[model samples]
Target: MDRSPPVIVFPPESGGGRRVTIRGEAVGTAHGLFDVLELLHSAGLPAVDTAVDDPELIEWRGGGPYDWNDGEADER
Candidate 1:
């Protein structure tokens, strides 16, 4: 069974921002890794800097952490 993580990073929109959700609740939009980490930290996730890269912690839908553009196709 492929269960999704608590945090999900949606694909980047035309504005170059990716939507972030925690436990299915929309949190905010992030334009970069720092923004993502900030959101996660604000959401009360510990070790966010390292957690951002953990597949078990976050699900990067469209692209990896570095992708902040709309060029990538949706990977959901």
Candidate 2:
């Protein structure tokens, strides 16, 4: 049986804040890598420092880590 990853980082919202979910439960919103790390830490997750970049540990949707932009560019 294939099991999903424990942590899920949703697509960036309108404000560049992504939704984080752990074990199928909504945890919080994160605007950057540090924020995601903090959320993982608060969730009592182990090895959060390294887990942030672990694809198997965290499922990044829409974009990978470091992608906090809301997909908008400034008009010249």
Candidate 3:
């Protein structure tokens, strides 16, 4: 059976915030997520947190599906 991939929508960082759109199926794995984060960080837009409805399906924010030891960032 085939399943439709989840959609990842990144909220804006500040003031009227811009929306960043990314495909879930294209980045539905740990590595893919990490790569996305790294890309964002490199672009000077590191995510403060991520949110998703389905935990088992995908981690929408804050390094989902991966162990993050850095607790310095606020996820509120």
Strongest candidate by lDDT: 1
For lDDT, candidate 1 versus 3, the one ahead is: 1
Write candidate 1's Cα lDDT for 1-76 as tens digits.
9787999998889877899999999999987888878888888886456887899889998788877778554243
RMSD of 2: 4.1
Q: Which sections of candidate 3 miss by over 4 Å?
A: 1-31, 49-76
**TM-score for each prediction?**
0.82, 0.82, 0.25
Against the true structure, candidate 3 has what lDDT? Answer: 0.36
List the pairs of residues colliding in candidate 3.
50-61, 50-62
Write the residue-wise lDDT of candidate 2 on 1-76 in tens digits. 9978899998889866899999999989988878888888887886456787887789988877867777433121
Worst 10 residues of 2 by lDDT: 67-76
lDDT of 3 by residue, 12-46 (tens): 23332223334432322223344445544544553
Pairs of colliding residues, candidate 2: none
Residue 41 Cα positional deviation in candidate 3, in Å, after optimal superposition: 0.2
lDDT score, candidate 2, position 24: 91
lDDT of 3 at 24: 31
lDDT of every predicted structure (CA atoms): 0.82, 0.80, 0.36
